[model samples]
Target chain A: MRYIASAVFVIGVFVIVTAVTTQHAAKLDPYMYDYMIENFEDDTHAKNAVAAILLDYRMYDTMFEALILLTAIIGMKQFLPGAADLRARDELESVDQTEATGEQSSERPSE
Target chain B: MSGPVSDTMPTDESIVLQMVVGLLYPFMLLFGFYVILNGHYTPGGGFQGGSVLASLFVARYVVYPVDDTDTETLHSIQRVFLALIVIAPSAVLFTGVIARNPEFRSLYLTTMDVLIGVQVGFGLGVAVLRFAFFQGVGKTWHL
Candidate 1:
């Protein structure tokens, strides 16, 4: 069943890849990129075109990215392990655990 | 109180690593400050400069070790900067609230960048300190 599912997924991906055409991206005006590149600085005052576009036009996406980072950090702080308990986070599977001092663990010693 | 766990680095020392880090850390700090101050006109900005500054602490750890950062102070600094990030811009943006100055917009951006750099630096410092403390290599703070 797993193999059959994998085969179907591969076929679906192949069909999707083959079906995409440039017609969807065909712009009415081909000079849009040039125009945007030239004008972004004038409008936003940012020297970097990429920064101008991302920060000027699409700041919300960046906001979401920041939100994700904060959320992950907060989640880790809240749920990483018990208070007064010290150990590497990934040491759950090993029978011999390194204390939070990280004296011994399955991971490389240098790490 | 759930304050930061203060940990001093171990006495184990390497002269070569210490010397190199001592030499490099100052330059890294200067570059980080430059990035923050010049973000409006240059390629680097608040986040980049802040990360660069944060790297100094990590390097110190690699050479010496304990994310010996004081979390309480860091938290306060982050708060202050976060306030600056909001207040500085809004004061300029809402022209009627403060005297309307033509140059306020550009000033706002530059100041915001500075505040952001400070905040990011503090934040990353806190993270490194916590990691060291929890990892158990860090010596607890004295005094």
Candidate 2:
């Protein structure tokens, strides 16, 4: 039952993405591409046009990409089996007296 | 007690794996740095270089499992790198520093690439090691 549900969900997503991309996809504008290729070196002082776009022209996107990476790390630290143990020793010490033992036991019963 | 209290790699006594990784680790690191440093001039950049470097940690874990990594330190360093990644560009972009000295633009690009590379490399290394440690626990939480 779970497999069937997952399969249905996956197929639905695939169909939706395919439909959206094929029918409603935005057309590419060649202006930005031409501008970046022609002016990136002079504007950004980088030899690579792609690098110039990523680091200079479209920097905010890269910043958000880094933030997303950090968020993933944070999320994993919070939800993983030994999540509590990911905290720094000093932080743990300040927060709890018993957990300061500095030993991580994944099998510890829930409080 | 079954799970590692600290970051630990799982190891085996396979000589071939150990020998091959021992030979390959340093080169991978060198290549990762090369890719990051030459990002503006070459096809590679921060994300690609960072993943390459992170693969070194994963390779090391496969070769010899041990407590070689300090997760807390990596975590702290990654945070710092992320801050620098944000601040470096913002400082230059907003303050018109790059405009004042056009020669500084390339330098800024390289610096941003390095900061991003470090952030990504450390972030992934910490994640993989922590996941390995989590798996070592041999049990899962119900909640």
Candidate 3:
């Protein structure tokens, strides 16, 4: 029952997204790119329109791309057992009141 | 409690070598930042730059011994710095989500460069620390 509900929810979301995208597609402004190119110097000093588009005009996309990179790093850290241990140990050390024992754990064995 | 590793006083020559490696580490870090900062106009970017910086820490561990001054404190510092590295990029993204401009754009590349530098620096530091702690020093005795 849960699987069926999840499948339905996923399909429902897909359908809604497709519908919205199709609607937006139909109303696309073809001249917008041309207009931006024509007005490039007036608005931004970028020599390359594409660079301007990516860095300035559409910097949000670039930001999200960076976010994706960050997410991948976080995901990698989570998936790696050693990283997980380090994270856990760090958290424990911060919260625990135990005195810093002079002895230190042996360094992790090199791969 | 795991007992402290026997404090073998590094000879003057060994200390000199370690100091040289330590000094070099900062320059390597600076170079990594250079790559990241000039990424907008140049070929190298955050990811590449960060990895290069991180590798220096690994190099440091390989070249030096895990002494009292360099082990636990350095490892803890790396962990803390890496945590910040993991957080800084997300914070920028969160700000973007909340601002919700119709364009949905952000001035995040600079932030990305800084965060990647931290991540690479800290991540490498941790890895080197772990390596030094676990593997002990290499066969080449500097002293």
Candidate whose DockQ is highest: 2
Listed per model in order, the count of residue pairs whose N, CA or C atoms clash below 3 Å is 5, 2, 5
* Candidate 3 lDDT score at position A51: 45
Error of 1 at B42 (Å): 1.7
CA RMSD (A), model 2: 8.0
Model 3 chain B is weakest, by summed lDDT over 10 consecutive residues, at B134-143
Tens-place lDDT per residue, model 3, B32-130, is: 888876654456655677778777766555455443224345445545554554465456444565245423222344555555555555555555454
- lDDT tens digits, residue span A14-109, model 2: 999999899988889999889889998899989888899999889999999999999999888778755345335445555476566765656556
Best by lDDT: 2
Per-residue C-alpha lDDT of model 1 across residues B1-143, encoded as one tens digit per residue:
46654443445466777788889988999999999877767788778889998887778667655434555566566666666655554455444432344344346456656776787776776676566556443244322
Q: What is the TM-score of chain A in candidate 3?
A: 0.48
What DockQ do the predictions score, one after another?
Answer: 0.13, 0.42, 0.04
| Cα lDDT, model 3, residue B74 | 44
Predicted structure with the largest TM-score when compared to the true one: 2
Regions more than 4 Å wrong, model 2: A1-25, A81-111, B1-12, B135-143
Which clashing pairs does model 2 show? B9-B65, B11-B65
Better of 2 and 3 by TM-score: 2
Real contacts recovered, all predictions: 0.10, 0.71, 0.00
lDDT of 1: 0.62
